[model samples]
Target: MSGVQTPSIDFDAFIFDLDGTLLDTADDLGGALNRVLADANVAPVAEHIYRPAASNGANALLEAGFGDKWPELEQLALRQQLLDYYAEDIAVHSKCFTGIEQLLIALEQNNIKWGIMTNKPGFLTEPLVQAIPSLSNAQAVVSGDTLSVAKPSPDPLLHTAEILEVDPSRCLYIGDAERDIQAAKAANMYSATALWGYIPSVDAALGWQADFNWHSPIDGFNHI
Candidate 1:
């Protein structure tokens, strides 16, 4: 997973999970949670404390930040507030993982289609995708709300493949979360784990049984 191997990129299309797989959005997400916690007079959580939860979205971030002091009754409002603060400066600290744009450009150069399928809601996904100019080149962008179901449900991945006009069997799905591998398996696509993404632990990621395990976007680029 660390050293790049010879290229054997046969997939017709590549579908990626937004948060951790392609972009490192932990600081922006963790920063948003800290802002929310500050409003509640709670202490800020460090990146190490909440980084793993970045791929799980805002709810997990709030949980990591507030811990036992989490306000269950105001959860919904607090979630919205965290989102508002995040949207105000969505890509302020977010950027593609090393070699992501290079990999993307490689895919494009080879006439291979690529897209994003994230559990992030459309509202946040839209601006965040826009803020990162490289992402605008995606052939398809499917948010959690794009369909009734999201990852762990194959629907979103299938929809992304549909948009790219590629068969599910010909798509390579890469992500940082277990749900991503599960979705790819359910969708009949090849699955790869982004080891460099916001994974909780390497043991848990290896347990996901991905077809390929990439230690970094550079590994992915080499594959292409």
Candidate 2:
């Protein structure tokens, strides 16, 4: 057989998913929810109770934590409470995952443009990213509210690439959810699954078809 050769593609930029990809934000989010529950005179929800559903946003947390007792009339109230609580305690226990700092510094040192593309709503997404010293200088950050469509639709990823002045195909997108892979695929970008992030048991790789999979942020450094 003839010797095989692999095609080499140079990546020019990177797009990251906010919650699970870069930050270990579950603790902050859970604390916010528990605060809201306590203020409502409800029993505090276990911090780990919301881990699986954290990436789904406030509604999921409320539903999972309170179920039918989450009164619609208090929806806005509870949401506001959670937001306020989270904002003040945003980075208290939240921190970059192991090797994330080094990876970010490496990307910067290499002069590679990197940004965030997240399904997180602007209210939480913007503040959380801004608070992270490492991501303070990000090239771009596209949130769920930044576009009419979110992940699983190519709009956000495409928008992020455009804002970063990078070609979509030359950008690498890393995320822990199927929607993240779907968005990257739709944008014609290279996609990788972040195995360290918050993927639920029901989430399967068959739907995502990521271009690659890395167990941690450092593992992605070489590929990027």
Candidate 3:
């Protein structure tokens, strides 16, 4: 917010990563991981233990749950089971991150184009978006499988810009992970690291070198 004000940068479109960026889906994703663990007679992991892994995807949650037992479990089958459990009730405890709804409304009122680009697969992403009404406002929703590759590759980010009909250079991509920053930079788009997202304690967000580092949706909105 200090270095660049709204007047300095005029982005044609805003592209956001789902999960930690837009929605606090940790509870629901953790629920699925718990179910997988329960099936294996393993005790459920606590929210704090799994929350940081939410944005990283299902595999991270599995590792959080399985721990040293990860090698012993049938990873592929457990992963599928986790997805099945999650898909059953994707939005049960999921809701927008604090201030996200207000930020999104502000964008809409200003006629700023915004869309979603996430590594969450289409099968899970579509239903989750449908379950949450506010999420439907996204002009475009590009999931992990929407392209042949996912984040860190930049193809999905580029494809999302293509779908939104915006030049990659004119787009601002926001997400939580280092891979998100990598993808946005690779796509030649401006990037922001969502500090409020599910970043692990060990990961240094500042090292990612994003154009902006927003501590919260309110901070991001104030800057915008």
Can you write out model 2's per-residue Cα lDDT over 46-156, one digit (the tens) per residue? 766787667778877877678678765478777877878888888888888888888888888888989998988887788788788988878999899999989889999
State each model's CA lDDT, in order.
0.88, 0.81, 0.87
**lDDT per residue (tens digit) for residues 1-224 in model 1:** 21123246588999999999999999999999999988888989898988999999788899899887676548889889999999888899999998899899999998889999999999999999999988889999999999998889999999999999999988989999999989998998888899999998998898888888888787766555
TM-score of 2: 0.87
Scored by lDDT, the top model is 1
Residue pairs with clashing backbones, model 1: none
Alpha-carbon RMSD of each model: 3.0, 4.0, 2.4
Instruction: Write one digit per residue (lDDT tens) for candidate 3, span 1-224.
Output: 22122344777788999999999999999999999888889999999999989999888999999999898878899899999999998999999998889888888888878999999999999999888888878999999998889998999988888888999998888999999989998999988889999876424887787888888887656445
Off by over 4 Å in 1: 1-9, 71-73
RMSD of 2: 4.0
Q: Candidate 1 versus the native: TM-score? A: 0.94
State every prediction's TM-score relative to the real structure.
0.94, 0.87, 0.94
In model 3, the clashing pairs are none
